[model samples]
Target: MVTPTESIKWKRRPLSTMGQTYKALNFEESVLCSPTQYFKRYIPDDLFTSIAAYTIIYALQQGKSSFNLPMYWDTSLKVNVFWENISRDRFLELRTNLHLVNNLEKPPENKDKFYKFRPVYTAIRKRCSDLPIEENVCVDEGIIPFTAKFTAKQCVRGNQVHGESMSSCCVESVLLFQVLKSQGINAVGTVRQNRFGKNLPFSDDKTIMKQTRGYCEEITSADEITMCKWLDNRPIVLCSNFVGKGSVDEVELWNKKHHKYVKVERSEIVRKYNHAMGGVDLFDQLISSYIVFIRSRKWSCV
Candidate 1:
């Protein structure tokens, strides 16, 4: 049944409160016997060979002879080996004819800009997706970062999304949850306040703050999506289909006012979310730590 988010009454509990202890699946079954087997998951040997053959053939077509090497090469008495047994001119000749897809069998350029790069792109995406999907999938902001200035970013305004901005990326969580529900996969993720949908009542930040630390509340949409707001150092909202505010537990949180760590309440939803999303939080931490801090007025300065 297609239930609207507004039609479902706000419930303070989970859709399923079954006391199932969390079990994390190990990688033993997904593991390959050897390094070669691991490597084949993304790039199979046959696919690699086909790519090499097509690329080489295209290079031959670009220059029937290696005489057209760039003037930058200087064509001096020095022998600059471009790639063992291949010279600058020969490499240029090969590069000019390089084809990820066979040049003869490629589709129209307008149909797909990825025609030449499709082979490698499809291989990795398809192979990785072939792995088993976990039930408690931790959904995070899946936006890839790009800070480089480019012509495409400017040209695509109002046409399609090219780069992700903080506001733009955070604004679409509600719809993301709904789509994941249709796939029959469970999801738990932190959602922006703006994405809470409509007609749903939630206490304002001031009201929530007035309550004791760890005081929590939740509401389930008519469609079974649950949103929980919990207080610790600050109020955080977690949206889920698999869990919500259940039995409360205490966790040590730094009390900035007191300058000490104190026990704060954490419910099942918060605990479940933190546990399931530990890897994602770690990944975010790693990437943020290494981000290039270049000062640029343009958003595309990646």
Candidate 2:
């Protein structure tokens, strides 16, 4: 019998079945829009299924974009039928291994640096590009709650699932800023949470608080790095600890004890980014005005 490692290797072996079919049909690469003619390869059934499933899910959640893994995966589907023939086990295994569904955080080394959710971000920036230079183009992160979906872990003190929280500025802050830059505007990201490491000085009263603290901190660090990259070119990017949503009650009575978080996102942005002329105009602009442009109409993040 083939071992798991052997099976994995066998599944990954590149097959040229798709090339033959394409050649027979005289299909043009430009018509398909793939970068290379060799893009039409027959990936394994299991691999194909994960790509197809995640492509759809990513498009739904993030939007379509250039760096989206889902688009790459899903594009291969029309040329091949491997995804349709895969067994359930093979499909699940492929999904879990590829880090598509996020059952857990990806290892630091494995995370792709260039994998930006392009489509959603492009839409947001394009919408705000026509606005004046001092308009507020706020940026935020939307974390998924996979743990919350699992009931078994609910009993754990720190395992509660909070509703969607949008930090005023996150590490993704820098990437978002770059998107704005492409559209003739400036932006930035920041965070201040401590969720990755162990034995931190965070309060234990609320597990979500502690986790969020670390998470935010990491985001802050990432934003700082990104901000430094654009310091010389676009010195007006903003960073802040503003959060848009918070949970007042936990799912269970014991879990719920009246906990909440508030954000001063507008003020924080003015303090960090320098274009608003002493923070007054910027703050008023955000508070008194609304940019009605659609930020991400397409599925760039898919």
Q: State the C-alpha lDDT per candidate.
A: 0.66, 0.32
Question: So what's the TM-score on candidate 1?
Answer: 0.68
Deviation in Å, model 1, residue 21 alpha carbon: 8.2
What lDDT score goes with residue 294 in model 1?
33
- Most accurate candidate by TM-score: 1
> What TM-score against the true fold does each predicted structure earn?
0.68, 0.19
lDDT of 1 by residue, 89-180 (tens): 65555555555677777655556644666677778878868876654554355333443553323223564544433221232555666675
Error of 2 at 254 (Å): 32
Model 2, 221-266: lDDT tens digits are 2212121111111122223223111112212112123354332122
Superposed model 2: Cα runs more than 4 Å off: 1-134, 141-159, 162-173, 192-302
After superposing candidate 1 on the true structure, give the runs of residues whose Cα lies further than 4 Å from its correct spot. 4-40, 57-98, 103-115, 130-136, 139-184, 285-302
lDDT of 1 at 142: 32
